[model samples]
Target: MVTLTMDGRKIEAPEGATLLKAANSANIEIPQLCSNEELEHYGACRLCVVEITHKNRTRIVASCIYEVAEGLEVNTRSERVLNVRKLVIELLLARNPRHPSLLKIAEDLGVKKSRFEAEIKGCILCGQCIRTCREVVGVSAIGYEGRGINKRVATPFEESPPDCIACGSCHFVCPVDVIPMKEKDGVRNIWKTDFPLQKCESCGRYFAPVKQLEYFREQYNLPPEQFSKCTHCR
Candidate 1:
């Protein structure tokens, strides 16, 4: 355990814990976006910045990624920090004016409206949905394509690639409610067709994402017999 002082209060945290996690443990309030407990720490939103003083110098760092150190002095709600956070909120509001969570955060920060033009993008490009789909669900169906400001999330070739498992993991991980799952006639749908009941060659039972079975077999070099035992067959 390591002891650190935050906003004039002493707190104990385990080693290798980030300042945001430590604050969360201590019940200290900190505003944030682009953070989910299920995914990795990505300090993209710049909303959790805090002032930290160490070795007689103070600088602003994103609390979500900054590790807590022994004897560290952290100020989560300083005047300068609040001002910067307000600006960050303003920027996000400009981009996502209709986002309910962003609007709530802006209201909490006392921002009435945004000064800049709205940066309207269909997806925020946080990569939470994509990473969760690939890493946790083992489906590399959707991913980021293009580069820089033009980047967007799509299946390979902008077509629903054959590898998509249609597990809805991406839909669940999205924070902005961009990816939506639709059901029609008892079948789930992504961008294109509704999920079909793939009959197992052996068992003849219906299953979801028939294509996923084919991709799995090809990817893992499984024999034809193994393919028959997949959800389609089992």
Candidate 2:
């Protein structure tokens, strides 16, 4: 265990826990958008920046990825930290101008509107979908393409990803509803790829995707009859 001072309150956290997790445990409101508890702590979004003074040296770091240290004095809402967080909100607002989440964060930070030109691409490049697909779903079907302002999440060669299972994990994890996916006619479409749904014999309902079932079978060595029914019916 490690103890730290966050926002003038002494808090204790488990060893190797990041400042964000510790702050969360203490109910400290450190605004963050590009982080999820189920996923690894990535400092892609700098909104969680906090001023920390350790050994009389102070610096700002993304709380989500910065590990909590013993005797660390942290200021989560310092003027410098607020400035950094507000600026990050503005930048994300520019990318997805009308996104409700971004707008709410801006409101909380006293950022009424962004000064930058609006792109309205609806993707803040938080890498949530990419990370979810790679880390949780175990299929790196989509990834960043290009660099700087041109960078975006896309499939290989902007073509249909052959390895995608149409499981909707990326879509489910996306903070912004940018990853377009639809299911109809027993087919699930995502990443410009179509996957047929498997019918459950017991319920006669289109439940799981056939490709995802095949992937589970391959990865877990499950029997073919295991996927014959959906979880609700099995």
Candidate 3:
């Protein structure tokens, strides 16, 4: 366990836990965008910055990736931290102003507008989808292309991903709500590809993508009849 003083409140966190996790456990509200409990720590959004003092040296760092330390003094809402958060929020707003998630963070930071030109990419490039697809979904179907101003996530050569299992993990994990996963007529569509939905044997209803269930069955080495029914029916 590590005890840290955050905003003058002494809080205890498990060893090696990030400050963001610790703050969450202690009910200390900290704004974040590129953070998900199921995914690995990725300091991409830079909205969760905090001021920290240790050994008489004070510096600002992203709380989502910075681990807590014993006797460390932290300030989640210091002047410098707030300023940094406002800048990050402003940039994110420029990228995706219509997204309600980003707007709420901007409102919390008191960022009314952005100095940069508005570009509605619908994506903030938070890397959540890429991480979810690679780490959780176990298929590196999508990844970043280009660099700097031209950087964006796309399938290989902008073609339909052949390795994708239509799991919808990336769709659910995307914080910006940019990735669209549509299902109709027992057909699942995402990333410009269509997948047939599986019918639950017990309920006679389409539940999930057939490829996703097949992938699970193959990975888990389950019996052929195990996934005949959907989770609800099972």
Candidate 4:
């Protein structure tokens, strides 16, 4: 454990823990996006910036990825940190003005309106979906495209990649809910591809995507007749 001062409160945190983890251990609230405990710490959103003083030098760094060090003095709510965080929220607001989470965070950060303009439709480009797809799902079906303002997440060529198993992993991880996966009637639409949902053999309720069940079948080497029924029915 390493002792550090966070927001003037002395705290002890496990050594080598990220500052975000340290702050969280101390119950110090730091605004964040593009970070999840289950995924790698990506400092994409720049919302968790904090003021850190070490060896007489004060600098701002993203706490989600910055490791805590001994004798470090961290200020999570300093004016400089607050200003940078607000600016980050402003940019995220510009990119996703109507995102519910973004709107709520912007309001909490005292950001009322964006000074910048964007044609954003939901995605903040935080890469949670991308990371989750690759890391957790082991399917690199989705990825980022272009650069800067032109940058966006999409299947290669903006078309559904064939490797997509219709698992909807991207849907659950998307912060702004831009992956466009939906279920209606008995069809599961993901990206630009629609997969017929399989109904439970016993309950007659649509439960799983056909493509996803097929993928599972291939993974487990199951016979086609086996997955005809959903997990509940089987």
Give the top-scoring candidate (lDDT). 3
**Model 2, CA-based lDDT:** 0.89
Q: Please list the C-alpha lDDT of all candidates, in the order they appear.
A: 0.80, 0.89, 0.92, 0.86
Tens digit per residue, CA lDDT, model 3, 150-188: 999999999999889999988988888899999999999
lDDT for model 1 comes to 0.80
Candidate 4 regions off by >4 Å? 220-226
User: Which structure among the candidates has the greatest TM-score?
Assistant: 2
Q: After superposition, how far is residue 139 of candidate 3 from its true place, in Å?
A: 1.7
| Model 3 residue 159 lDDT score | 96
Candidate 2 stretches with Cα past 4 Å from truth are none
TM-score of each: 0.82, 0.96, 0.94, 0.93
Where's the lowest-lDDT run of ten residues in candidate 1? 225-234
- lDDT by residue for model 4 over 12-67, one digit each (tens)? 99988999999988888888879988888889999999999988999999999999
Model 2 residue-pair collision total: 0
For model 4, how big is the CA root-mean-square deviation? 1.7
Candidate 2 lDDT trough over 10 residues, lowest sum: 95-104
- For model 1, residues 1-234, the per-residue Cα lDDT tens digits are 999999999999999999999999999989987777777788877889999998999999999999999999999999889999999988877656788888888898888898878888746677888888777767677788999878888888877656667777788777677887885553678857467645556665555555555666777898766655444335
Q: What TM-score should be assigned to candidate 3?
A: 0.94
